[model samples]
Target: MPEWMRSFGRAEDGAVTVDWVVLTAAVVSLGMLAGVAIWGKTGGAAKGIADYIGTQGVDTTPM
Candidate 1:
């Protein structure tokens, strides 16, 4: 009913900001998901490599 309230209701700036916030959140969420997936795969591979290296004998004799 007030003049300021009517103008605020018709404003478009806040709407654009809201859209951008939602889009950014979606992108960040996807990145996190990809990171988690990659991390799981790499974590296993890393552990395997560590185990292999740990089992190898070290030759310390001078050539």
Candidate 2:
């Protein structure tokens, strides 16, 4: 009801800061979700590669 309170409510000085914080949070959340989705496949692929490498024999022939 007061003039000062009304002016404060209408102020836009901190709007950009609030927008940036929200945007940053959304980006970080999306990145974490993407990483979690890929992590399972990554681990499986890494294990398969390691198993394949472990089966190969090292040749020690001297020139």
Candidate 3:
């Protein structure tokens, strides 16, 4: 109803800040997703290696 309130409502100065915030959040989310994928695969590979070694046994044991 007030002129000042209407002007404030139409302001564009903070729009860029909002866009940057949203973009930053999206980028961080993608990075986290990639990190989780890599971490999960690495863990699985390590577990597989351990299982193989356990089943095959070490070729030699040190003195």
How high a TM-score does candidate 2 get? 0.77
Q: Model 2 RMSD to the real structure?
A: 1.7
Per residue, candidate 3 scores C-alpha lDDT tens digits across 1-63 of 999999999999889999999999999999999999999999999999998888985658688
Kindly report which residue pairs in candidate 1 clash with one another.
none
Clashes of 1: 0
Q: Compare the candidates by TM-score and give the number of the best one.
A: 1
For every candidate, C-alpha RMSD to the true structure in Å: 1.6, 1.7, 2.6
Ranking by lDDT: 2, 1, 3
Candidate 3 vs. true structure, TM-score: 0.72
**Candidate 2, superposed: residue stretches over 4 Å from native:** 1-3
* lDDT by residue (tens digit), candidate 2, 1-63: 999999999999989999999999999999999999999789999999999999999999997
Estimated TM-score per prediction? 0.81, 0.77, 0.72
Please identify model 3 stretches exceeding 4 Å from their true place. 53-63
Would you give me the overall lDDT of model 3? 0.95
List the candidate 1 regions with Cα displacement exceeding 4 Å. Answer: 1-7
